[model samples]
Target: MVTFEYAPAPESRAVVDIKSSYGLFIGGEFTDPADGASFKSINPANEEVLADIAQAGVTDVDRAVAAARKAFSQTWSKMSGRDRGKYLFRIARIIQERARELAVLESIDNGKPIRESRDVDIPLVAAHFFYYAGWADKLEYAGYGVDPRPHGVAGQIIPWNFPMLMLAWKIAPALATGNTVVLKPAETTPLTALLFAEICQQADLPPGVVNILTGAGETGRLLVEHPDVDKVAFTGSTEVGKAIARSVAGTSKKATLELGGKAANIVFDDAPLDQAVEGIVNGIFFNQGHVCCAGSRLLVQESVYDDVLARLKRRLATLRVGDPLDKNTDVGAINSAEQLTRIRELSEVGEAEGAERWSPECVLPERGFWFAPTVFTGVSQAHRIAREEIFGPVLSVLTFRTPAEAVEKANNTPYGLSAGVWTDKGSRILWMSQQLRAGVVWANTFNKFDPTSPFGGYKESGYGREGGRHGLGAYLVPSERSGR
Candidate 1:
């Protein structure tokens, strides 16, 4: 056997100019937090302090919501759809112009690989704005009738995992549907959203149309509970989603929550082992498994379970894991110390409960938060690792005797966000897609997404969809059920 090593090829951080301190973005401008309280945004890769980020308080949230409502009533709602779409189109173009900058900043603050930030996240972010821009002028044909009104003053909060991409998911649709937004990016990764505030200015977007408030959980609660806000959109944990649901209950506020997931990647004996192995690795390791729809559980048919597991480990060995800026790095640093702690705790529980844990021979960086890509064999259906959403690069291998068993185990979890199928039989793919209780099913692939397809979860995974025409309803008033 032979192995090859490559020289270092890191992306240039010079493309991004980080300021020493920052303020909240409201009414298309930056302002200091009301209480003068702030926190540092640290790079998880090296524990480097990126910048001092202001923490928005209750008054800030109130101001942002007021700004959005003013924009909705005075300026945005009166504008022609085509004109609003022109702004979306302009924003999309500017995103491309500053794509490299956003990618580098995203990697710096969020600790995802530079490759993913540049290629996957940024491109998709632009596509979302472009796709919804077309829909902006064509809402009459959107099946929501000739004049589908928007729920003014959308209040959105996004997670730290995929900062720019999640912002695009929340803001693009809401804006396209004629709504004004007051959004809160996660405290740790608010840099890109602030950068996006600059983009909004670059596009000459109307004042008060888009406001960004960066803060922690209390700030999020204050924004969601703001009486003037008409819609709430959140992407985070299931517990928080439940609380948001409770907060909005009986209120006129329409809410959409995209929460946690424990997706099952099912591989049949008849499937091509080589392709299945590649898919399995991609399923669990993409974005370091921070994806809500990540296929964390591998439900292989009993006949070829051992063979598939061996192939998966061999493939994992080829993965590069360090230096997020390095062009060749496959896996990057975890988003934060807190998230890394959660992953370690869940993995330890998997080991304590008698599962065989294995990791590739990978040396981790000492300064930053890092976790080696892991696989746990002999994982039971009831195991914590199998059931809980371990939002890291960890895979749990479980076996099923029959196709029915595979479907049964896959649908057993509270999360019905997504599932994967790898089988040679076309009929089996069709049947499994129908049987799996998931919002989205990927055949022969995992973690694939596009702006044209709607994505969300069911049950404990939360409700409502994002993307495509269906996603438009989340920001609409009395949204039609049949055509939508």
Candidate 2:
């Protein structure tokens, strides 16, 4: 037997300077809230305190909304579309310039591997802004009619999984369409958003064009329910998405929600065994499986099920699970203790439901929340693990006899966020893509994202798209109005 040893290659934490405390960013300035309650955001990798974040109350939400409205009416709305494009272009350049620092800050606060933040998240954040910036001065040619109008003030609430990226998804399109925004980032990962406020300042963006409020669910609720807000955009749990839908019902507020998923990755016998195994791993284990569109369910053709499982187990053994700042680390810590608890509880239910659980022989850190990459075999549609979104480094494996069976099983879930199909047959890929009811379908690939592609979900996974030209519709109203 031979063993290989490796040295730790941790990135420098000094790249980002943490403030002792942060205030709400409203009207282009950071201000203390009337209600002084605050929360601390900690690094999930080691449970180290990162910074203190303000908790926004109803009064604070009101102030932020007022600022957004004022910016919309007095400054941003009056700005020329071509000049608006210039501001967005400046923001994109600033993000590119500070990309490394933002990547480090994102990894520390979000508990994702530095490689992902540096390579995938931060770069795409800049790309989203650049892509939308081009559309600011060309909305008439965007197929939305002669003169689409911007919604006044958008209230956007984002999740912690991909903080900076999600912020870009919401704010970029809203700004491109001439809408001012009040964005409330998730409480767990609010640091990068505050940093983004600083970036806005660096770009010399007009005051009140973007307001960031950091707080818990109540803060998000107050912002979403604010009557003065013209639009509400959210990316989180399906239950909360429903709550927002209800809150905005029978009102003038428009909403776009990107919610939960239990996407199925279907593998046929024709798929290259090694490549299929890699896709399975990448689909479920990326970001500690915190992704809403993660392929949590694996459906394999029965003819090659045993071979696929063997190869998958072998690949799982090589995955390094540890400090997120380590460049070589494959899987990082769970986002929070609460999310870790949810993952563990669901995994326990899987065991109790007669499914077999397996994990790699990897050691976890002592102090922080962690879960080894896990897979459940013999998972049936009736099992909780197979049906629900674990939202962690957990996967459920099920088998099917034919392509039709795979398609049926894949679409059985209430979530239609994303799905993956792996096979060499071109015709079969197209056929399966048509059968699966997911918003984003990957053929022979998994977990791929680009700024030009529109991404969202169907059914209970929530409504509306978040990327590409389609995203502009969420912030614009049709030029021709129907009589009420």
Best by lDDT: 2
lDDT of each residue in 1-484, candidate 2, tens digit only: 9988678999998989989999999999999988798999999999999888999998999999999999999999889889999999999999999999999999999899999999999999999999999999998876677888899999999999999999999999999999999999999999999999999999999999999999999999999889899999999999999999999999989999999999999999999889989999999999999999998999999999999999999999999999999999999989999999999999999999999999999999998889999999989999999888889999999999988899899999999999999999999999998999999999998999988899999999999999998999999886773110
Clashes of 2: 0
Q: Per-prediction TM-score, please?
A: 0.98, 0.99
What does candidate 1's lDDT look like per residue over 1-484, in tens digits?
8878978999999999999999999998999999999999999999999999999998899888889999999999889889999999999999999999999999999888999999999999999999999999888777786678888999999998889999999999999999999999999999999999999999999999999998899999999999999999999999999999999999988999999999999999999889888888888898999999999999999999879977888899999999999999999999999999999999999999999999999999999999999999999988999999999999999999999999999999999999999999999999999999899999998889999999998889899999998998888774454454
lDDT of each: 0.93, 0.94
Clashing pairs in 2: none
List candidate 2 segments past 4 Å from native: 481-484
- Span of ten consecutive residues with least summed lDDT in model 2: 475-484
Model 1 TM-score, 2 decimals: 0.98
